[model samples]
Target: MTMKFPFQIIDLTHPISPDSPSWDLDCGFTHSNFIDYEDCTSEIKFRVQQIHSPLGIGTHMDAPAHCIPGAASITDLDLHRNYLLTQSVLINVSHQTDENYQITKQDILDFEARYGRLKKNVFVLFYTGWEKHWPNPEKYRNNLVFPSISAHVAQLLLERNIAGIGIDTLSPDTADSGYPVHQLLLQAGKYIIENVANAHSLPPIGAWTLTLPWKIINATESPVQLIGLVR
Candidate 1:
């Protein structure tokens, strides 16, 4: 079928590999070739690979079950919610440092004041310029001061009926043991996309996003391929 609107697709996911940086607690991504073409004897050479990694590794989407008990899992997430074609808004919080940096409700209000009100079901993205440190576990994961979304800001987005939230960092919350933003968003049946790349390439508004997550039954989260369909 032909698309109604022509779009320039912008990838927003980082390549997953052994070198990909994951949460300190999650297992590192790895892959090995099980069947190589060099070992094939048949006329048609076959190759197979085995992969092992945690669900939260790489660019992924978190289901409500990730933090909320008795909530929906990766497979239970609505397809419409996982794959959405709606307006997206990018809030530039890149200037804010990790030390004492927090995205507050006031930040949302200020963004609206400058870029206009956020539309319902809009995919809200935060560009913290964190992707510049991609693939470097030391700089990207350990030493990085990731800006986190405050609980109040999360509630504000919920009130706006946002489809989901994405960030160019390992997570939407700080490295604290308790993640209030994740708890609030997930418990509300809203999804969160983490480790998003190229967020800075998107505009403050008017971009459309398409996020595709793996269908893993009863899984709390799944890696995703997020794309921005720019006009």
Candidate 2:
């Protein structure tokens, strides 16, 4: 018997199906088939193919080169410096206000107050309860104008110099497309994790972060295996 705590695995990757909505208009996007092998299956050779979204689709990681110039790609990353990060903090900001639906410095401060000084090199994940309405595309993408880190907040992350920053939404910046926040973080070599799922399942603190991006050679970005290991 494998002894473990009551663990919940949140599939950060979006469902890759025909019914699955996608913003393909933004870029050339496609979710291919995801295969699962069952050793004791009765079906023929014991192989099943599951179709899923693309590398950047669903729960995925973003390389620094995404929004910055002359930055490193996913393939050129330092795994020791990136994956299986220590001191993971899940900021459950689900009960956020809607004035601007923006994650201000005050919010971060409040989190710091309760959590006792967010240490450096830890993965900072912002849980906004955004994935709940993923079944509804419009609401998930437009209706829920959830809190996002400001350009100034990006500077703070740089100041903290954390290993990586992640979010449950499609992006860390607002839908404005071209923003200074993304620019600053990318330029300063800040790694971003996006399209996170089921973050609410995580504890407020003490869980481990394991976000993995594919090493597509000379690629700007790739899909990631976003896993969180906790006690």
Candidate 3:
């Protein structure tokens, strides 16, 4: 099948690998060849590899079930309806934030003042300049002091009923905060994308996001292929 489009597709997902920063170090990514070429002695030769990765490795999507028991999991999501070409609004707070920075509702308001009011169901991405530490396990993790979204911002976004939120860090919540943002957003049934890459290249409001995740049954989270289509 041949398809075409007049848009620039930017890959927003970090390449997952054994060295890719994992939120949980114990669950780092690994892969091995199940059927190697050296094992094939017959005319038919093929090699099969198996990968082992935690749902939170690299760029990933968190289903509501991630924090809320009985909430929708990866398999229950309507990919086309919820993620297909969804409008993306980037809230660049990099200039004003540091590792311990917490994004607030005022930041969203500041963004709106510049990019115009965000519409419902648009995927909101935060460019925290954290991607600079990506692929560096120690730095990316940074003792979990990375920038995060405040509960107030989460509540405000919930009120707007945005499609979801994405960030260039390990999580939306600060480590010491006990996942307050995660609990609030997930319980509200909104999905979240974490460890997003190349977020700095996106416009404030003219890009659309296409999020595709591994459809793991009963899984609360899955690694995802996040892409941006510029308008």
lDDT of each: 0.85, 0.68, 0.88
lDDT of 2 by residue, 62-179 (tens): 7778766678888777777654455678887778745246677777778889986777777888988777767876656664355577877777777877777778776777766356
Off by over 4 Å in 2: 1-11, 18-54, 97-100, 143-146
TM-score of each: 0.92, 0.80, 0.95
The lDDT-based order of candidates, best leading, equals 3, 1, 2
- Estimate the Cα RMSD of every predicted model relative to the unseen true structure: 2.3, 4.6, 1.8
- Cα deviation of 177, candidate 1, in Å: 5.8
Give the per-residue Cα lDDT of candidate 2 at 67: 61
State the displacement of the C-alpha of residue 203, model 2, in Å, after optimal TM-score superposition: 1.5
Per residue, candidate 3 scores C-alpha lDDT tens digits across 48-143 of: 899987788889999999989999998888876665359989998999656799999999998888878888899999999999998578888887
* Candidate 2 TM-score, C-alpha based: 0.80
Task: Give lDDT: candidate 1, residue 58.
Answer: 87
| Two-way TM-score contest, 1 vs 2, winner | 1
Q: Poorest 10 consecutive residues of model 2 by lDDT? A: 19-28
* Weakest ten-residue segment in model 1 by summed lDDT: 77-86
Itemize residue pairs with steric clashes in candidate 2: 13-59, 14-58, 31-53, 33-51, 34-50, 55-223, 101-147
